[model samples]
Target: MELLKKDNYYHIYNREINSETVFQDANNMSYFLKLVEKYLIPKVNILAYCLLNNHFHFAIEVTADTKDVNQAFSNLFNAYTKAYNKQNSRTGALFERPFKKKTG
Candidate 1:
């Protein structure tokens, strides 16, 4: 996991474990976005985003650039995964790994 730098733009992404569907329905997508808004919006300025069946992408600019940024991402995924697992009656990891990021 790379630490986000202040004022830096980045492309961040993640995929579902085993190439499985992450957003099974419209409600799932909405919930995931809500989690993003809650946890990521404060840390980065979102430029663009795409949420597919098994993966998600984000174009963003770092805002605060604190170490807590990673924790925010972790919280976002953890919360979403927990909700998804409970809703779908499944358990274990949701994402393939910690999200990957690149300068863009």
Candidate 2:
């Protein structure tokens, strides 16, 4: 239902649950970016980005190879969340379920 179609442009964003701090420190940001590079850089053409304490945004163009863009993003978020929870000793969801995106 929330597929990111190929050949489309999207503005993507998500926030931590309840506006909780997602990036508690610089390492968290670095890890998230690394995950993004690992999962998303291969699939889409990233135009711009903004990373904050509790949220992040990306403007990207889906490439032909991005057939499973949403899954790739999910992997990125899940990986980040797992590591974050282990690092911070927290539980439950970190980001709000189902990230937001809009074609543009």
Candidate 3:
């Protein structure tokens, strides 16, 4: 249960492969925000963030057990992929990785 210990913050991100556009337009950004708003809001406290063309940056505090982060991030990432696929009419992953974590 050591990973469950509530002791650090994490900055996590993933990029589109080959430096492609992740946020093709404003709606993509909007969709990502909505996903974060709905899923990551309760479990994680976001300190800062920036969404660029092909990647995103987030500074967040995990107030509870660290085990919860993967699920929280998965929800956000899945939402993004669904939106991206629907918008772009393509399939497969949007992110290079599903989840990445760091201790802070």
Model 2 per-residue lDDT tens digits across residues 37-91: 9999888999999999999999999984555777898899899989999988988
Ranking by lDDT: 1, 2, 3
Highest-TM-score candidate: 1
Off by over 4 Å in 2: 64-67
lDDT of each: 0.90, 0.89, 0.78
Model 3, range 1-104, lDDT digits (tens) per residue? 13423546877677886579999888889879989988888778889998999998888887756667657777788888887888789998888764455667
What are the models' TM-scores? 0.94, 0.93, 0.85
Error (Å) of candidate 2 at residue 46 is: 0.7
Model 3 misplaced regions, further than 4 Å: 1-5
What clash pairs does model 2 have? none
RMSD of 2: 1.3
Residue-pair clash count for candidate 2: 0
Model 2 residue 45 CA deviation (Å) reads: 0.9
Q: Measured by TM-score, how close is model 3 to the native structure?
A: 0.85
> By summed lDDT, which 10 consecutive residues of candidate 1 come out lowest?
64-73
Query: Candidate 1, residues 1-104: lDDT per residue as tens digits?
Result: 55778888899999998898999988899999999999999988999999999999999998885677777888999999999999989999999786889997
The collision pairs in model 1 are none
